[model samples]
Target: MLDALRIEIVEVSNEKVVARCPFMMQPDNTLDSFMGSFNSETVASVGSWNLLDMENEYAIGLEISANHIRGESEGTVKATGFPIHKTTMVWEIQITDENDKPICFSRCTTAVNKRIKKNNS
Candidate 1:
């Protein structure tokens, strides 16, 4: 059963991945069971999620603002290579296996965009 469950951070963006969840999403619902059964910090595994090259090629940069994030959070956001911002953020999870080796890693890339465009006028 354990062998059936494995985690890895796959780009899974655009043509990167044609499918979802390298592992099964549903698990036996028990007191210990969770939508995410990771045993480590969620951010430990993920590093950063960045804009696609195609995205960066368009404009000088995204007009990131508070609306770019869900809710009114002003926390630090980051892209894979970018230092930090509020438009795009990264979430990573790390889990160790019975052999005490780093086995599972999962990350999610979520973006927030400005609802309105601010004009310099």
Candidate 2:
């Protein structure tokens, strides 16, 4: 899905993750501006699992809140995610345009779950 949207993971680490989406490749709204869903997707793509050291466990988004502060019609937009509360699996994301101007802000909460193995019975 990220490929379809042309979203690329530029960086990743235990403390932060960054992604980029270029306007030329993104789907636009009626006004030919960036879609808020792009911000949501960018925010969600960071996934809380990436920040955790636990193996065999993955995180699924429980809630997401995005604020589309401004619109951009051209250039690449960057989304950066950082842990808000590691234990609770909360994160904050900030999206900015090529000029480094604020485009969106978001917060996400996820639930960590053990990856269940399937029994081929």
Candidate 3:
């Protein structure tokens, strides 16, 4: 589903994760303007999930707050996620345009736990 949106991982490490996606106005937009909030949130969530890298675990978003600062209608937008206050489940996300200009800022909090195993008969 994400691939369909053209979101891709740009970088990943123990410290942070970066992901990018092409920006375009949603087809349902009547104003023909770029709606960046949804894409920004998606990248932020995905970045945090990748950074966690909890094997056999699940991470569900508890909260996500995004501030859309600037709009970019062309090229790709990238989001970088960093841990906040050294906490494993809280992240600060920054979204930038292709030229590395700030587009959005976000904070995400997620609940992490082991994935429940399914019983097989």
Estimate every model's Cα lDDT from 0 to 1.
0.28, 0.69, 0.66
- Candidate 3 on 11-120: residue-level lDDT in tens? 77657777878766445422112334445455556655665546676677777777776656677777787776434477787878778898778777777767777889
- TM-score (C-alpha) between model 1 and the true structure: 0.23
Give the worst 10-residue stretch by lDDT in candidate 2: 25-34
lDDT over C-alpha atoms for residue 102 of model 3: 85
TM-score-based ranking, best first?
2, 3, 1
lDDT against true structure, model 2: 0.69
Kindly give the number of clashing pairs for every candidate.
Answer: 4, 0, 0
Mark the regions of model 3 whose C-alpha exceeds 4 Å error after superposition: 26-56, 85-88, 115-121
Q: Per-residue lDDT for 1-121 in model 2, tens only?
A: 7888787888888778888876642354221234445555456546575665456677777787777766667788788888878766787888888787887788877777787778799
Clashing pairs in 3: none
The predicted structure with the larger TM-score, 1 or 2, is 2
Worst 10 residues of 1 by lDDT: 65-74
